[model samples]
Target chain A: MTDRPALSRVRVVLVQASHPGNIGAAARAMKTMGLSSLWLVQPKSFPDAEASARASGATDVLEAAQVVSTLTEALQGVTLAAALTSRRRELSLPAQWSREAAQTLASRAEHGEEVALVFGNETYGLSNEDLRVCQLPVMIPANPAYSSLNLGAAVQVMSYEISMALATPAALPVYGEPLATVDEVEALMAHIERATTATGFFNPANPKRLMPRLRRMFGRIALERDEVNILRGMLNFFERPLPGSAASTIAAPTRDDGKA
Target chain B: MTDRPALSRVRVVLVQASHPGNIGAAARAMKTMGLSSLWLVQPKSFPDAEASARASGATDVLEAAQVVSTLTEALQGVTLAAALTSRRRELSLPAQWSREAAQTLASRAEHGEEVALVFGNETYGLSNEDLRVCQLPVMIPANPAYSSLNLGAAVQVMSYEISMALATPAALPVYGEPLATVDEVEALMAHIERATTATGFFNPANPKRLMPRLRRMFGRIALERDEVNILRGMLNFFERPLPGSAASTIAAPTRDDGKA
Candidate 1:
């Protein structure tokens, strides 16, 4: 697979990061996703021992990170910028799910356009002014009840999406067999209905929505072609009596005539 | 949307945790993802000060965490267990990507089956015996060169995926206007081409690759119906002379004949 040079063109910018430990953790998260560019805008504390200690082995990213006075300075030379936020603000930039935003940024970066993903302070998040500078707002669709994603955690999620978008697409694991088509599924259902009717299990004259309920149950399973065939074959066997069986000697039960 | 009761049935298990701080961080990660159940197996330390300090306001989860002596005790009532690992092991259970595994777990949980997501020690992942007991192995696809995802980070990613899988799908933020259909976009492109040709900016007789490139650029934007109309209106204005312009006398430049 070709290396995604786009990952290098993308910058991860943190604005007014108050915790040095979070900065270190974010750096580690970026490195794990094969990203190296880091920009700090008006951080409260930098060149701190705690940041380096928390970085694990990603000190190289911290050492080479660019520190700027303002978010605008951090976004210098960036063609596109996306602001990450958890809160929904009125009149903010158009918001996209993190995955969609990652794809857009990767596409632009692949075409040699510089892209920046801006993060906000741990507690307050991005201000309206900070959000206005960004063309898009990206949100991680976390649980609504408890959506307090730590700064490093949020960065990790974003980086993970960006890496997955840029990396070669992996083929989804194929289970047992291909799923049956609509026609095949319908055929199986019809066969089962016919078997049930012949066996007096279901009366066609007074069917009380049993067939539709069965259809829904089968629909949920999404059976494969082979499974459908096996089920139909079972139904066919049930439609007939086994050789030398007592059931074959017995007459079929008549349907209830309206009399209680 | 129906609420996903499965989230409540899922438990997060950390085995042989060496650092008390990681335990706290993991609890915070779980809470952020809306998971409450936490089980610890053979942890080196419990009720430690470091753990409480790092839990960041998720002390409730830590306090409610179940500390057990063995992995079996931790998985007491789990109907489905997924072991999180970074390495591929032979003779292991079916391995799935983290997201896929989360979906499976969530589906099972929704059906009232208890589910457990197990994580191993920080230094060494799950042992072979431990993995054998689990029904599935889940791997997070990080950068191949540096796949050292911290334990808390790994927990956060898994929790995020699981929470997303179980939560009701949130509506994507709608921007200005609905996107144009393929035919509408094509018609708009044709109009622009005609206008550019008439303005002497492009020649139909010797049409170069400008039209195709322009189409690709517009395709990248995925313009809305309103955007298409605005572009065509601008093109129409460009085709004719300005209100007071002198004969629209801007001469078309000759094509570069490779003589430069």
Candidate 2:
């Protein structure tokens, strides 16, 4: 189980739900996933008997649900709001899979940021306008043939993902090995360029793409402090000859080695 | 859109539904998730006006719905059946999360196996008998405080997961980069050890785990053929003496360098 405090930071927002029963059922779904904050945008009805009956002992969630007039009004103070949809849009917001979006939401919530998972109406999903308000558009990969998830079910799926993400630790743990700071990486790159230039291994006058490739390689590695130190030490070997070094007698090469 | 033929192999079974509207809503949920085959195990009411009204244009699913008397009849030729419930059992079958269960179902259906996702009544979930009949029990991790997921919502979550598993490609794509084969990796390790031995850098007799550490490091990198070849080429520079070789004349060292 995840800490309740962290779960409390997550809000489940339903936009324009036509049925009052679905609103109640969505509250039930949210309660099951440990999400307490419920925001209802332009709901057709509230305090309806049908919603309370469908909630099935989750009336507490419905009682605490915030009824709002607009999606933007419901999203106030949220650091990240993910719009859940199965439909594809032409000019879409930045998209992520449900799992990825859940992880992002969980991580942000852990750091004390408010997060919201937004759902659309039963008949139609989020309009482009709703998606525009929410920066992150999350798509639950569904069967391409039908690809329609009910509003409450969408809530359950997102809630389940968020709960699971909070329950499980990160897939890859860095183990406290701090990554090399941007300044440290920049210094290493500059040091490499200088050393390679001095050795005639890199021609500064005709430096086409070697530096950029090396930069990309380092970025891909996501170099830790120790890795940066080791790489810099290797470059140092080429920059200056050690005491009693035999290679020092040889003149610096005037030709490139054709190596990256 | 996903190919429909694969989806047609999946069956959705709902047992003893009391409300006609939930049955209709479940059918709609299944249709949205691209599941067509629905078997109702003795529903209290079918073809009810409320159900038709709740279906909201998914009447086709209701039109084709199969009303069966027994769970065994509903499971018929299905090879894999996943029972959905939130309850914990003392002697339960193997349990999986909805996503994991969905992946399993998708893969099995891809191989032409008939798959069934079973849901129980709203008040009481699946009995032990129902679970025993099913091969895998799937649980939606909902909040511990309020874990009641409505019948329609449960169907929607499972259907959405199955559809998404089918529509999305595997999370990590190799991108046609064939990793170095075991034999190739072994050959590289052997070549590195030999070169390091010849360079008076590695003491073969008193080797203190340097070779093993290097082997593990390379394994962690998951080196491709090109990367392996490049690394071996770098080692070659240390193995054989160049025209003006001075370091090559040095005798093999007795001490270890404390470097991996």
Candidate 3:
């Protein structure tokens, strides 16, 4: 139902899957990531109730899956196939981290080439012949001490990475007001300088790089417009002179362009 | 057992998880990613045989998991907490993409701050009160049409992202042979020019941009030493004269340095 053109060309192929639940879970994983293609190679069971129940809302993916007898048949038109393995084997190519493998596959799929991400059985991974059939070996980096990832979890992680690789970079969310305008920032800087001078925290006569340091610090904060208004309001409250203060009338200079 | 110090400080808190199997799967996911701390708040069932069976080799994590009565108790010492939510809610902050949220949490954990990644129930996600309790809302980008990620699968994706964020940059694997040396490449270019001219493919009198184009193309290939040797061997075969042609005796010029 989603419009993921590249993902549509990327298929998830599970080889000799034993547990039907895992097959169902993998279908759900692929569906969540906008991938619909599924290929099964000699699964022990199919059209089982366990799989349907486990697939939850993604039974559409399971119902439409292609079940084939062998891995070769499953990879009919795949231009790029990545074998998901946990370790490096004798004649296998150097294992790529899943993220990099996903990127490579995504680029190929984006260019209208069919690609497959193949996973082996839960107990024993791909055989030597199966590894040789694929173009690349991909590994998910895990704790070396305990590197056993559940079959369904592995599928979820790989699917998630592929979705991320194919997605357009999204703009970071802005929680509140838009960023302060340049003029607003400059005005805030001026107001800060005036308040600091009146409070005797910063002496304009001996201003020792304080304004420059403040400017650098504020530049990093990237304040929102609302944040700027709040700061200016605080400054105004601090600047108002007390009613009976000694020559509160002695106005702090509004601008000290040269010193600032 | 892992050397992941930052990951050790991350706690996975599951609130009111309904299924025991999902609990076990979450534990396995956390252990695979090097995160050891797990907190369960009011789970429907725990220490069940089904949960233990599903945990597979990660029973150690489940055994060590702390069961708390409330979310506040689960979040006792946490400094930064991210609520894993699938959608934006009424009073919640703008949701962060899971990758950025992982980076933020990882940095804080690296600085020795206790951080928690909180997940809600399978049927109903974090309540409004639970979401408000956490500092940030995190979302995993998914298909708009079918964004229902299973509870265990969400844990797997989040744990993978956190592990990736905490991991040091890894060097790409190197295959069989070393890269061709600069001298070796230059010599191969020289040999190529000699062979091409001898074959009458390039005439020194009107050599226009061919050698430069070849050099530019070769620069991109980054051939290994073995590949360079193969190319040179093929050139040598092509350059050998046929048995007894008329002026096949006329040898090709050794070098066309000026024209090349």
- Using TM-score as the measure, the top candidate is 3
The regions of model 2 sitting more than 4 angstroms off are A171-260, B168-260
- The DockQ-derived docking category for candidate 3 is incorrect
- Estimate, for each residue in B150-260, the C-alpha lDDT of model 1 and write its tens digit: 788888988888887886777876554577999999898788667555444557899776677566546645666766665555444444433222222222122233443
Candidate 3's residue-wise lDDT over A79-179, tens digit each? 56789998876534556899988887787677666789999999997876576556668999988888888888899999999999888633333334354
* lDDT, candidates in the order shown: 0.76, 0.74, 0.79
Highest lDDT: which candidate?
Answer: 3
Q: Could you give the fnat of all candidates in order?
A: 0.25, 0.39, 0.42
Better of 1 and 2 by TM-score: 1
Candidate 3 chain A, which ten residues in sequence have the lowest lDDT sum? A242-251
Q: Is candidate 1 or candidate 3 better by lDDT?
A: 3
Candidate 2 per-residue C-alpha lDDT over A59-142 given as tens digits, one digit per residue, 9 for 90 to 100: 999999999888877877675678887755543433678888899888767766677999988788787667655656788766
Which residue ranges in model 3 land beyond 4 Å of their true spot? Answer: A169-260, B179-260
Clashing pairs in 2: A32-B142, A32-B143, A33-B143, A34-B143, A141-B164, A142-B163, A142-B164, A143-B163, A144-B2
- By lDDT rank, best first, the candidates go 3, 1, 2
lDDT of 1 by residue, A37-90 (tens): 999998899989988977888899999999988877777667567899886665
Residue runs of model 1 more than 4 Å from their true location after superposition: A168-260, B173-260
iRMSD per model?
28.8, 9.5, 31.6
With a 3 Å backbone cut-off (N, CA, C), the pairs that clash in candidate 3 are none
- Each candidate: RMSD: 26.9, 14.8, 27.4
